[model samples]
Target: MEGNHSAHGAFILLGFSDRPHLERILFVVLLTLVGNTTIILVSRLDPHLHTPMYFFLTHLSFLDLSFTTSSIPQLLYNLAGHDKTISYAGCAVQLCLSLGLGGVECLLLAVMAYDRFVAVCKPLHYMVIMHPQLCLGLVSLAWGCGVANSLIMSPMTLWLPRCGHRKVDHFLCEMPALIRLACVNTAVVEGIAFILAVGIVLSPLAFILVSYGYIVRAVLSIQSSSGRHKVFNTCGSHLTVVSLFYGNIIYMYMQPGASASQDQGKLLTLFYNIVTPLLNPLIYTLRNKEVKGALRRLIWGNLHLRKTI
Candidate 1:
């Protein structure tokens, strides 16, 4: 392991090196990047999507894009060739960005849930309640919280002395994997991390569930079945995304152990890092009628202009 650490402070990423085939399949991360970019562009270009929901969605897409880009490109580069080493600075940036973006997503999802709750329970006041100023403030708060989490956690994790043990068992420089590298006792760090996890992960999730509970009651009170279905359709995509994002995150972070199994840890990380981002755009676009219409208009509008020329 001494050879894995360089004099200039580099860490060897031992990500799926033993399984070359799996590395090849992980290239799907490219699609994750593209999909997130499309969501950002479409949401901005379509005037019909100028509501608070799409506003939050645009931020979510940006976070996903930044989050995946921070790690996946390096992973792919390592997988593509023999060089599996990441500079100490590079690893630190990846860890910080991923942590910050992930934290933001958790809080943002809760914000979106609240937006849904207002839209459903108090339709007449939805616009007044979720005004532009409030939306911006909420998003800013989420970003601030995420940045604070990363500042608190990333530095502590990175400060641990590896003592020449620099080979990370997983693909990216995650908190749990980095913690495992410390030569000294990490019980204190682990405890702090667990506490933060509860605050950052579980708290938002509970909020989402509670918001949905109110939403459910409101839907039940609607006399028309079509109204109920419409409300469900509007929110189902968000629910699906919340389940996918939080389920994997809770299992990965909320466990007593940082990661029970290194192999399992890699797969779960890959799922959220790659698969979830890829699916988010698909889930929203396919399930959302407004987005689909906007996309069609954008496409045919361009086509018609070209034909006229």
Candidate 2:
């Protein structure tokens, strides 16, 4: 009974509960759902998007979709009603799935950087190197590492002695928020979390930085300003995404022992979880001519189909 009580505990997620604007939260959720859905739909339907970059992008959009879906619906439920309780199993699933997606995104972005590196630096060998087999392997590696990390960490987090503190102050069953509920000293967990962050977050970040460094050198070696401009434009959207994602994550987890102000942490979480995913489709589609072309064709095709009907 004691084990059951401790292990299978419900959590009260007090996410934005203090705010007066339930409607605003709903609006954000709607926007996120729409954005993620649009990216996935367009990527899948448009043959013009059948390249390696778009392949990774579609996966990223899907990742964002699953990541946001895992938590936001429940958040909407809580924000709309009086009840904010999440079952122990549900919370554990949320933690595992969300973390896995996040970790995947981190590694996926790095993989994307390597793709860009190859495309820019080794234009002649780009196709040969970034073949279907290699692309698949890289994506699988990213996903495998992410799920493996989450499986290791989530259960450990759920098993921590909470001493009956069931209220999670954040909107989700995040590792940091869950750890905060622990009655005992989490020095070891924090240390391990930092190490995991280094592996999952910082190591990939370093690789991205190094890859981009080479990319920049390659881009600059081109004598024509127009040539350099084209290369930079291709890389810009990805760099923005990397900055948005890694910056917030590194800040949050790099120092696991340091407790961020709850309000600040919540705001950062909101930016990455809801806002960043929402912006991804907009960023890639708006900046890339191919995506815009695909969107146009998809829209016209749908219209033509309707007219025929």
- State the lDDT of candidate 1 residue by residue for 1-309, as single tens digits: 443353238889999878877877777877888888888888999899999999999999998888788898899888778999999899999889977988999999999999999999999999999999999999999999999999999888888777788899989988888888777788888888789889999999999999999999999899998898889888999999999999888877765244567788888888898889999999998888888898899999999999999
Candidate 2 residue pairs that clash: none
Clashes of each: 0, 0
- For each candidate in turn, the TM-score is 0.95, 0.94
Per-residue lDDT of 1-309 in model 2, one digit per residue for the tens? 554586677889988778757338545766777877887788888877777887898889888888778888788787678998999988999999977988999999999999999999999998899999999999999999999989888888889888778998888888888888887888988888888989999999999999999998898799999888778777999999999998888877775443766767777777788888888888887887778888899989999999999
> Would you list the C-alpha lDDT of every candidate in the order shown?
0.88, 0.85
Off by over 4 Å in 2: 1-4
> Which pairs of residues collide in candidate 1?
none
Ten residues in sequence with the least summed lDDT for candidate 2: 20-29
